[model samples]
Target: MLEKVAWMNMLFDFYGVLLTERQKDFMDLYYCQNLSLGEIAGEFNVTRQAVYDTLKRAEQVLSQYEEKLGLVTKSTAERNKLATAAAMLEEYETVKSDGRVQQARKIIEEVLEM
Candidate 1:
């Protein structure tokens, strides 16, 4: 459940501007504000079923955008690559009594700029 919420938050951050105002509002309330479906519906003066349906649709749309755009996928890949490259650089730095530190640093810089 926490993992789903975390992914939704990431997806929302990436593609939320593409969502409608009402969709964004409900998502923000549900995810960010930590509201229950009934609470959200009450706040909006709607039925619990209506809130559930709206949030369900919103999740569907967000997932579809992620599938087509893949911004989150690309971003995660790049971040993982960068982290691995950084770790390699750190390891090399500790063992570089042979003046290879500068070379390793340059390659790490290139990875970061990617």
Candidate 2:
């Protein structure tokens, strides 16, 4: 459940503007504010089932957007590559005279530009 919220948070951060206001509102209340479905249902004057259904649909829409655009996937991949480059840069900083250190620096610069 925690992992689900974490993924939802990431997906929301990436593609929330594509969602409907109500969908965004429900999600923000449920995920960001840590409200239960019952809480959301009561606040919106709806059944718990309705809140659940809306959240499920919103999740599906977010997934579809990620599948088609792949912005989140690309962002994660680039972030991982950048992390690796940063670690290498840290290692290279200890031995600046190595020729590979300069190459590492160039790669880091390129990734940062991206």
Candidate 3:
């Protein structure tokens, strides 16, 4: 359940602008704000079932966007690779004070910052 929430939030961060305004609002309320469907419905003056349907559709759309674009997946892989490279560089730096390793580490830091 927690992993689902985390994944949804990450997807929302990556592709939320593609969603309709209503979809964005409901997703934000339900996932980011941790609001219940009933509470969201009350705020929007709609039924709980409507809220549920909108959320489901939004989830589907987000998943589809991820399937096609793979931005989240690619970003995760790149980040993991960069982290691994950084760790290896750090370990090498401890054993040998190499200028090239320090330069490579600096470049990795810059990439990670982006």
- The worst-scoring run of ten residues by lDDT in candidate 1 lies at 96-105
lDDT tens per residue, model 3, 1-114: 999999999999999999999999999999999999999999999999999999999999999999999999999999999989999999999999999999999999899998
lDDT score for residue 66 of model 3: 99
Model 1, which residues run further than 4 Å from truth? 97-114
In terms of lDDT, the poorest run of 10 residues in model 3 is 105-114
> Which lDDT tens digits does candidate 1 get at residues 1-114?
999998999999988888888889999999988999889898999998988888888899999999998999998898787778778777877876546765776776776776
Candidate 3 C-alpha error for residue 57, in Å: 0.1
TM-score of each: 0.82, 0.83, 0.90
C-alpha local distance difference test of each model: 0.86, 0.89, 0.97
Clashing residue pairs, backbone N/CA/C < 3 A, model 2: none
How far out, in Å, is residue 72 in model 3? 1.0
TM-score attained by model 2: 0.83
Q: Which 10-residue span in candidate 2 carries the lowest summed lDDT?
A: 95-104
